[model samples]
Target: MDKSAMSDPQQPATVAILAYPEATASVVYGMYDLFMATGRDWGIVTSGEAGPSLLRPLVVAARAGPLLATNEVRIEAQASLQECSSADFVCVPDLNIPPGESLEGRFAEEVEWLRRCYAAGATLASACSGTLLLAEAGLLDGQEATVHWAYCDELRRRYPKVMVRAQRALVVSGEGQRLVMAGGGTSWLDLALFLIARSVGVDAAMQVARINLIDWHAIGQQPFARLARTRQVEDAIIAGCQTWIAEHYCEHSPVAAMVRLSGLAERSFKRRFQLATGMSPLDYVHRVRLEEAKQMLESGDDPIEAIANAVGYEDAGFFSRLFRRSVNLTPAQYRRRFGSMRRALNAGV
Candidate 1:
């Protein structure tokens, strides 16, 4: 089928991005911008002085008033938490995980909310550590969930029942649009584009990717995707090595160490690791640290120095600068924007 044959894919998707004080503006704004462009490109809605208004991307709050992002970006929510009930697609983007009760905090409310939303046929999505909230809500209790890699341990420990696949680009489960996970914040662009493709058609989705300068492709199977090699000797070794690293990322090791632990030769371990996991062992570790820093910035108030050290960085200043360059926000600023939630409630006096 040609791209010209289908249009109006946007009709079925109603994306309601939840604005938790810590939710990144990049994720929110990026999704809205790309989705709109996609709608226009696919002829789901033509662009002109008089264009169709088929796709509506909105930022909604769990309560009221303006919300802040990690970079101090502010945006107003058009609907309240009550509004998720009406949305066809519901998102709980990067909600700040308060240290102790990030998941358990307001767990009952969100769980009930998800139960209702899912029952009503709304698809769900989360970026960064937002999956913790979904896990709290029970949507991911027994399903596969992918989040920023740093929190993989916590997710695995907290919800032992759920199969937490850490260090992945994303995870898609539940038929049609039941559940979706986008790992890195930047990956949100990819997820949104895929959503657009479904709603408005591929041509429009591709156009948006072109406009956003995003890379959209089915490159060799996902680097993080699980290989179907079965439980072979090398595969077992790789799994043990992964378990070892998760426990001790701060300690440095050469390929020989991983090889010895896996009981495989360095050459064989390197080859199978690449095939099973799609990345060299060290590349995977760096990916984990980066993901951890992202989650810390969005949910906690620890200084960059503390966060850096806690996440395996000994040089606080270097980590601070490197993190900002990578995430597009200083660690401190990212925390202020995405973690702290300020509510203007009960002031009708």
Candidate 2:
């Protein structure tokens, strides 16, 4: 339970990005840009709701002194590290705190401030190596957390009392209290946007997404699929081909054309394609067509032949057979089942 991850309910969700005497500029700028880009008070000004909040953010340095910046960017700090009041969320952001120098002496000051803030009802959060700050603070002594996978082993080794889990994007603990953490450098944006969404609303979160050009689905979502690491290059090729196929399904692009895009020789491409996706290129194309046919069947009233041809299938029976084989149901049956599910989900909501 990294103390930084635990958010306080009473705080207007102020994130005071901690500026260590030797913190990196990238982390500092990243935190600053991410927050300002994503956060804005709508000033609904309703009598019932709290009037437009003045709770913005401040980047402060430890020890109430000037701090060295990374990459020669000397940003001024307006608040002292000891100025821990007026914040519901305090972020160490990202910095490398040496293991031997942490959890004691000078590091004690930051930890004490963190504990005080948490006790005062502020959520404390860290990003990447910033988790080390919390571990040093002893808040993670018996709690599960996630750091960048490269640092997970070292964090666990240095603080044996902290239970480290590496499989997820973000780790959360503390019910009334909160301890949430993330792996990967860019995941900091995810954590920040998530905090914004929780404190504000989805509109603010989406603004963050547009600012960072981030994928909307992954923000605030946990247990991110590790599949990206396993087959990133291959997946990119496949996704490119998939997009091409979807756009050109009606054009009836040849399998050889798709195989060429994979950059592998025909025979080798077929083998790898089947190994990667469990289906040959043409079979996958056919599957896509059949899937589209199923979709058409639900919202559309076109004839089966027209739908089949629209998805690159000319023979009606062949399309039906392929659709049934891949989807475990006939096109009509799939339309019924999935359409029912979609309608039910929408209606229930």
Candidate 3:
């Protein structure tokens, strides 16, 4: 799959989408539809005539047969790993594997095939947890990548050589910039559009997006991330403090209050707190306060200053800056993005 051939208008780019039992059917079929529509749908929508097909998408699995995918959806593979030797693009859709589970002993054949495809000059793209396959195949080593926010920690833990950009919606890295990865949820739409724009043209990609009414996730994943609750630790003292702080996070000098409640020397308590929670006492407090602020922003109509004060920050400017750094959005922007949805749900209720 030469780059020139992919860019040529006369030849359609072949995209092989890898599928397995754990794969999500929606992402696999959604990308197939988008790629298949690239150059063909625009003409039909505008001029009442179908245009030339710019991309040929085929679902490639370990064996050519029907397999049940996540949520009990049946997916038919058009080709097997041995049959599909090479293509202009290789796409791995989201897999329904748990973030903390080991990927060892899984997708052995598919991983080997991906390595061969990359060696043959095929561009590799993954959506969401599908990036795990590329990482497991060692294609993402020493390259920047991103996955769904929940999987970011596990990706970094397993592949220390890969730089994890958890806040980005999309990342393009690796040799010749051929590896493309999308972040959580529907960001695969971004990945598909990027590949289309790169291979065919930006105009074709834009036309497809318009036809599908796909909204680009430009703000990235930070705004959508919820702070994961700290798991219960073996240290009873620290665990009790955690429970106390969750309710008293908006109080003055919450860390010092926790130290007083722990009944340990201040320095010893801070050391033990970090060891147990994997975060400094002050950082933990900020996380709790920010989590509360996010809830207020989503569920209420409070002003920024009022929300900041309620979240234990008297200085509204400092709160605003900290919120922007942590959540990648100001209070108003967070409200605008999530408040409407909250209101809509409330209205439905």
Candidate 4:
């Protein structure tokens, strides 16, 4: 387990992919296929001969046997925690558990195995909710990490010491940059490529990507995130205001109109709204407007200025700046990215 030996190109790095009942089958198998392809598949496709395998990927579970994963997919584990004592890298695939669900007694053995791997100089990596396991293991304390966007808030709430970057598609942190994570969805492809590049070589990783037609998620997760909806609150007045604002967000002085509709003094209305929704009335209005703008940009080919006006912003420059600040992408950029997706789907239909 010499760290220095890991740099040798001739040495195939051992990758232990953790599998459990909560694991997603696609992520587990996808990562396994990609890692197995790293140094060997490219040459086979090009010259009809396999090249040297650079990584050894093993599906490791608590018990070495067939297990049912999320969605009832059967996964055959190559080794158990007790059998796989150490590895050069440990990968935790996306878990199907809800973000807010308690992990109080879950993955106890897997977490302990991860801690042992880290202590043995193995790099730890996760995809999506799998970052929760790393956090639960106390491996990500005070370290910056990224998870599936929906889980980012929950991760922050559960582990205040861990810095969560919801916008990043991939993040590398921890001592010697040993911890790596990929954001939600299929960004696990990026995680696999990154580890291959780091362990084998960049050329090997690029070849694997080309062979698999895998593209890196360079745009990050901001554009894909659905704006958090304002949940209905116990306060009837604020709840009524929320329903009203959803329809009339494009109207000028909407917050003022809401205040009047609330039938309370403006000062009292604002205070009650904040207490109910956790944001000021004006901020809530902006969220509604931006969410509408996002939908229009994704579904239509309207000009940016026109979309801005439709969303209640007359000054296109101001709208663009605000959109960039809030969504991390300008209206035009968001359209270009998501609009094409819409069209592609429509064309197929």
Residue 230, model 2: lDDT of 25
> lDDT for each of the candidates?
0.65, 0.66, 0.91, 0.89
What is the C-alpha lDDT profile of model 4 across 84-106, one tens digit per residue?
88888999999888766899977
lDDT, residue 109, candidate 3? 98
Task: Give the Cα RMSD of candidate 2.
Answer: 12.8
Residue 7 of candidate 1: its Cα lDDT?
31
RMSD of each: 14.4, 12.8, 2.4, 2.7
lDDT of 2 by residue, 86-175 (tens): 476777766655433444466667777877776777777787778887887778888888787556656877889988876456777653
| Candidate achieving the largest lDDT | 3
Candidate 1, residue 316: CA error in Å? 33
The digit string of per-residue lDDT tens for model 3 on 1-349 reads 3446655767788999999999989999999999999889999999999998889999999999899999999999999989888789999999798777888978899999999999988999999999999999999999999999878877888999999999999999999999999997799999999999998899999999999999998989878777654555789999999999888999999999999999999999999998886689999999889989999999988899999999899999999999999888888988998999899999998
Per-residue accuracy of model 1 over 1-349 as CA lDDT, tens digit each: 1222123454535677777666777777767776555445434334443335346676777765687776789877777667545566666676555423454565565667777777766778787778787777767867888876556656776778778765456687765657888765467766786666655678767767765679742321123222212223446778787777666666655355677888877788888887766578666666567667766666556777777887777898887777655555567765664455321222333
TM-score for every candidate vs. truth?
0.57, 0.53, 0.92, 0.91
Deviation (Å) of 219 in candidate 4:
1.2
Candidate 3 lowest-lDDT run of ten: 1-10
Q: How far is candidate 4 from the true structure (C-alpha RMSD, Å)?
A: 2.7
